[model samples]
Target: MNTEKTSSQPAYEPGGCLTAVARGIALVVVVPVRLVWDALGYCLKHLWRWVLAPLARALGWLIEHLLLIPLRWLWEWLVVPVARALWWLVEHLLLIPLRWLWEWVLRPVARALWWVADLLVVTPIGWLWRHVFAPVGRVVGAALAWAWGIAGRISRAVGRALALVLWHAVGRPLAWAYRVVLTPVGHWLRTYVGRPVAEAARAVRAATREVWRALFGGPR
Candidate 1:
């Protein structure tokens, strides 16, 4: 008799068939891209290291030796000396004399002018403002206040007199007419004419409502 044995373990499942296929495709595509990128990087690295770097260094050295050195020397020797001499000349010849003139002549003249201006303009103006204008303004203000008080008193008195006259002339007569004449007349009219007219109107409305109800079908 021959016997066969079967293993009873679960099979390994790393994702599924789709994931494996996708991984295979990714590897196939990425290998060439990675190889190309590496080759480009290597080439660029060597190119920069050997060719571009040397060229840049040579250019920098040439600039430093030829252009920069000469410019620096010119600035240090020619430009600096010329600038110093010109500054010295300006300071000695022009600025010094101007400074001296300003200190000795212009300053004193300005001071005298200021003193004269103060005496002629500022002092007189200050005096007038303090003595003349201030006193006059105070007096005018006092006069205006007194006149205002007088006017206010006169206005009050006039207003009282007018009120009294109006009360006697117009208000008292109107009050008497309303109280004595119009009150009796209004009461008589309301009693005789208004009551009769109101009663007649009520009768007419009641008759109209009755006629409408007789013609139409509605609640009585």
Candidate 2:
């Protein structure tokens, strides 16, 4: 029997000339950029570590010792005691006197003025309005209302009488004349005079049309 040997490995080929050229171009372009980036990183790291960090520390120390310390001492020693003394003086001299004046003098004076105004002006006006003006106004209003009622009754009676007089004197006569005399006259005229005149006018118009038709030809 004949047997054949089989292999599971894949084939490999060497790179071409174009592949080498491309690799060389990429290397030439990337080397200088990579070097520049690394150098900048190194420089920045050392600058921060040595120069910038020390400068920041020195500035922080100077501010704490020179400015903040002196200000703190001034606030604790000088400003605090001065402020306390001024507050004490204001409380004793100005505020206490003003409070006492307002409580004792101004308040009592205002109360007395209010009482005087109430007694002199407000009380008298209230009494006059309640006692004198109110009663007088009520009496006058009642008298006017009574007069108005009487006048209204008289006017209504007069109006009714006038209506009755007009009905008897004018309205009844006119209605009677219209119903009796004018109605018969109008009916007679419409039947006899108006009907005859209209019929005569129609006859005359027909005769005139016949004459015209005879003289001329028939209507064009």
Best by TM-score: 1
Candidate 1 at 177: error in angstroms? 0.7
Model 2 — TM-score against the truth?
0.62
Best by lDDT: 1
Query: Lowest lDDT 10-mer window, candidate 1?
Result: 1-10
Residues 34-124, candidate 1: write the lDDT tens digits: 9999999999999999999999999999999999999999999999999999999999999999999999999999999999999999999
- Candidate 2 residue 22 Cα shift, in angstroms, is 18
Q: Give me the runs in candidate 1 sitting further than 4 Å from their true place.
A: 1-69, 206-220
* RMSD list, candidates in order: 9.8, 6.0
lDDT of 2: 0.95
lDDT tens digits, residue span 161-192, model 2: 99999999999999999999999999999999
lDDT of 1 at 161: 100
Q: Assess every candidate by TM-score.
A: 0.63, 0.62
